[model samples]
Target chain A: MNFIRMKYTKWFNISKDGLSKNNPIMIAVLGICSALAITNQVENALAMGAGVTFVIVGSSAVISIIRNFIPARLRMVTYMVVISSFVILVQMFLEAYFPFIFAALGPYLGLIITNCIVMGRAEAFASKNPIRYTLVDGLANGLGYTYVLVLISIVREALAFGTILNIRVMPEAWTDWVVMAIAPGGFFVLGAIIWIFRELTNNYENA
Target chain B: MKDYLKMVIFVLILGVTTATVLTGMDALTRERIEENQLIVLQDAILEASGITDYDDTISTFEANLEVIEAEGKTFYIDGEGRVSYTFEGLGVWGPIFGVITLEADFETIAWITVIDQEETPGLGGVVEERTYLDNYVGTSMYPELRVSRTADADDINEVDAIAGGTRTSERFEAMLNEAYQAHRDVWLTLQESAGDA
Candidate 1:
């Protein structure tokens, strides 16, 4: 009973760390390129978040399973192969089942293999941890990344088009801010997000 | 020698595993992906011809569409006498695909729908907007459609370009003109053939 309780606590802490303290997008500052690029629309942001989450969890599990066999010198290359395999799977599934989202995502979907969060988790946590812990870590980190992306997308889509998920949320009188729909807009939103998160956490060392 | 051999074996195994997994997934999704592409193309054709009720687009298309093969190109003649064809052209980032429909006279654009594009989101990507595409409708193909900055222009062939997507708009105009010129002769011949038949 004590062992099971300890295990549960460990899992909870791992998830907690991922959601807040060691958040991939906020504290770690990984995978910012995609977070910026795809957040212009809420739908795109959600699709991206789901894609990244799938890639991270899938890659982490594989990496953890193969950690014992992977030679130290050839580890990075092996990780790349594993990561890309999962990315390709995700791409094919999206193209087949969700063609509109697939088309909207375009090259950003392929860029998931290079997303720092996936590789970072594989290196920092998965390679050393057991499979169960690694899976939990991956899921936690993915959720963390997803929440931040969704938050940024809400801000961007609302300001830029006066809409969310392509639906008109703002009144007709509200003028669209064209700048907020572009790349520079992503910078301001992401910067503000990092600032707010850091303030709330009161962990200024990384900031 | 032992370390080198180990590295080679490890890499070989990894490569083989990756290939096998990808191949299995490709086989599983190939049919569905192809079907999706066909649906998208069909939707583009119907939308270009101004058919908005897409719940039965495929059946409607089959019932009304007359496919003409001319000069190794496919031209679709709709029930309303408009002729449509897909156009591929270079955009800022990647290839842009559009379906353009011509009036029965074959001299004016009846409608246009940008089926696919890989332009910068919110900027060049405005090319896919309905407003931008609607500008092409009713434009004359004689001088070919040209994108101009000034809105409410008098020229029948001139349309307004997206403010921030100048390069993509320019490329789109050039692509349309080139495609129209390339298929003009074939289209005329097909129209004549239909008239005779």
Candidate 2:
């Protein structure tokens, strides 16, 4: 019974670490490019989040399963190929079923191959962990990344376009802050989020 | 030697598996993707022709469209006599595709829609925005359309460009001009033929 409880606790901690303690975007600062670029609209943010989640989860699972077979020196290249294949699959699926979101994402969807969070998890966690743990870790990290993106997008879209998911949330009199719809806006929002999170956690030593 | 051989075989197997998976996915989605492209094109054409209530049935709208194949390209003539031409050009990153509709006079633009582009999001990608596209409506295509950073209300052929997307705006302008010039004579001839009939 104690052994089982410890196993469960380990799983919970891994998920907790991904969610807040070692959050991919806020804490580790991985995959900031897409976070900034796609957060202007809530829909784009959601679609990006979904795409990243799919890629990360798929890649982590595959990498974990094939970890033993990967040559140590050639591991990075193998990881890239696996990640890109999944990315392509996501891209094709989006193009066929969700063309609007696919078009909106444009080249950013293809750039998911370079998102460090996917690679980082594969290298640090998935390669050493069992299959189930790797899958859970991928899910946890992807969700963490997604939540941050959605939060930023809500602020950006409300301020920039006076809308959320293209629906007008702000009053007609509310003038748009054009900067909030661009890269600088993303940087400002992300910075403030990180600052607040760090302050609340009192984790300045890491920075 | 054994380890090296194993590594090579593993990589070879992975490559083959990836290729097979992608090929299968491509085959599965090819038809639907092509169909979606058609719908997007049709919708853009309808929007350009000033038809805002396009959600009902595309087939009904398509029924009134006369497709002309000339100069190895397709041009659409709606029931209202508006002519639409699809054009493609290089954006900063990839091809920018759009459909532009002209009034029967072939001089005044009815509307324009950027159907596809691979521009960087938020910057060059502003070309896809309705606000940016709205600037082309009622603009004259005579002489040539000029994308100006500054608003020139007096210049009928000039439209305001996206603030941060100057290069993309310029490329879009060039694309419109080239496409118009290429199809101008053929479109006019078709109009004349229709009039004669």
Candidate 3:
């Protein structure tokens, strides 16, 4: 039990456990808003995933670096300041460069700051961990979240347009399923994935 | 006291370093991003104008292009290299804006580009879909574009209006007509300016 109390050892163990396909979105059902909103197209999902991953890694590093200076009462503000600065930088860069995507993904990028997945990772993992391990944990979780998003977007885009990444994969005669492009379609696909993953991993946790 | 001061300094240094790195990346990528956006916008305009895969040089596109303004919206003309017809319309929601580059006779729609709209997705979003917008490509502009019932196959301008989006279709028609009128008005102004020139 004391081995679990070791700082670096605990950070690695918890990060792996948390991101192990059985945790959060797949297992505990968290942070599904952007997963629903941005998964309509693979390009949108990739942009969102890359943005979130950057913010999570940066914020985690900043929080870990400042763990000592942040008083208990102002810890939340400190974490938010770190997360938001990264979020704004991402937003400004996207706006200045990718105007079309910036238009489409406008408010959702800002909403990443409020995403519990990011805050949760900061408070639960980064707060106590060393800087090096915290960055790894943040990267793992971000990649895990991205993996789910790409998977969901793949199904939605293919079925909706009869293609992957907008390249026509289906024959001309194939009638496209128009329903797949609507927002609700993402929810149905996400739920099915979560169910399948849970069923597959349920045995290991139980036994 | 010294430990507290050191902690503050450490936090400040980390924050400053992060900002510098992010700003540096922004500076490097800003130009490429703008270039990509201009390409997409130009492509959208070209598609609406019924021109595709033209040489990417701006001068060629600009030479064949004309601008018309009326009723608060602006339009670009394909002009068939001359003053042809104009494509103007309001969108299903917001401003249904597009450029209808026409042949010199002003009777046929050479290409139509929907520049902006706030129409409902899955319904008005069809404006961007090839199935819908492409229909406007070769439509006749003689009696005006009409949104008749789905069963009305009597005329080419009589496109079947969107089923549930009746008001949107009506607004689209009105806007289309407004765009045409605006184009006509602007075309007259352009003539006046040219006559003086």
Candidate 4:
């Protein structure tokens, strides 16, 4: 079991250097811009998470399948083409079925193409990995993003509405901190979350 | 050179596929989307006008209303009944639009619906929620309705503004007042007609 597991982990599992030591959105903090902009509402955050998950998975799979064929000089362009196509598809589908969320999310859905997390995963992990491992990386990164987004939305919604996800979880007498619904509030909460995650996962280096 | 041509062909193929799929979906969904919107509008008119069970078969109230533009804004009214005009204004950074159905007297506000707004979701967007919009239900003004700071239901001049969204409240007041003034001149004619009758 050790021999087989180590062999698998060696290529697929994030390296110790990549783990808690270089957490993508926290320590390394590649996609913090979007983290701040789209964390104001639970609805937008959920839509964003879905869009990112779709784009990341699609891009990862596409990149892995074509990795051997892509010329080194043309690799970035190829990834961009693949990623942007998925982003447009997600945007169109959301507009069709969930126009309200699409309108709320506005231009941010299209911006997923530029989110460093997508390109970073493709370049850093998917390009070198097999299909199975490429998927693992995509799933891990998507979950990582969803975790942060949900955390931020919880704090923002609770403070703004005196509720969590529209449920009146707070006491009647509690005063909502109004600023928490703003973008600046998202930044502070997200920073604190990244810091806490870093401290908790500190033992695993880059776990 | 050949590789570049192949890449170009691939991009063209993908682009065409996406455009065709999205356009086809848009066409199929357009009618349903319009039907859904008409349904909401019908519901709103029925709810606000305080008329119910008049006709279940009706889908949309053909707004016989006309838009009269003046002073960089638009006011709407129809000949049959009193003028019920919608006003669009800015609440904080987003848009706030409402329906104010004037009574036959034209000065009193019979019904007001904050039809749509794009203020902060949980806080300011509460304009759509019952607690805030309900304040305007059955609301009337002898001269001009005023907004209160707290729950001053007794205050003749004020309505209790949403606690955290004071800016939105202030904007609504200003816009409503502007709308009231704009409609005042036309309202005089309706009053004159009532007097003659």
Best by DockQ: 1
Task: State residue B103's C-alpha deviation in candidate 2, in Å.
Answer: 3.5
The candidate, 1 or 4, that scores higher on DockQ is: 1
> Candidate 2 deviates by what RMSD?
4.0
- lDDT (tens digit, per residue) of candidate 2 on A1-207: 676676568788899888989999989999999999999999999999999998989999999999988899889999999999999999999999999899889889999999999999999998999899998899999999999999999999999999998899999999999999989999999999999988997767644
Give the whole-model CA lDDT for all candidates, comma-separated: 0.89, 0.90, 0.73, 0.72
Candidate 4 achieves a global lDDT of: 0.72
User: What TM-score does chain B get in every candidate?
Assistant: 0.90, 0.87, 0.60, 0.67
B17: Cα error in model 2, Å: 0.6
**Candidate ordering by TM-score (highest first):** 1, 2, 3, 4
Over the true interface residues, superposed, what is the Cα RMSD of model 2? 0.7
Each candidate's root-mean-square deviation in Å? 3.9, 4.0, 6.5, 7.8
Q: B131-167 in candidate 2: lDDT tens per residue?
A: 8788888999987988888766459998888888889
| Model 4 TM | 0.61
Model 4 segments more than 4 A misplaced:
A1-22, A68-77, A203-207, B24-197
What residue pairs are clashing in model 1? none
lDDT (C-alpha) at residue A68 in model 4? 78
Please identify model 1 stretches exceeding 4 Å from their true place.
Answer: A1-8, A158-180, A183-185, B91-93, B118-178, B181-185, B188-197
Candidate 2 chain B weakest ten by summed lDDT: B49-58
Task: Choose 2 or 4, whichever is better by DockQ.
Answer: 2
Question: For residues A1-207, what per-residue lDDT tens digits would candidate 3 score against the true structure?
Answer: 465566457566756666774365776566799999888789888899899889889899888987876766567867887888889888878877677778778669999998888898889978998999888888888877888889999998888888877788888887877777877998899989987877777623554
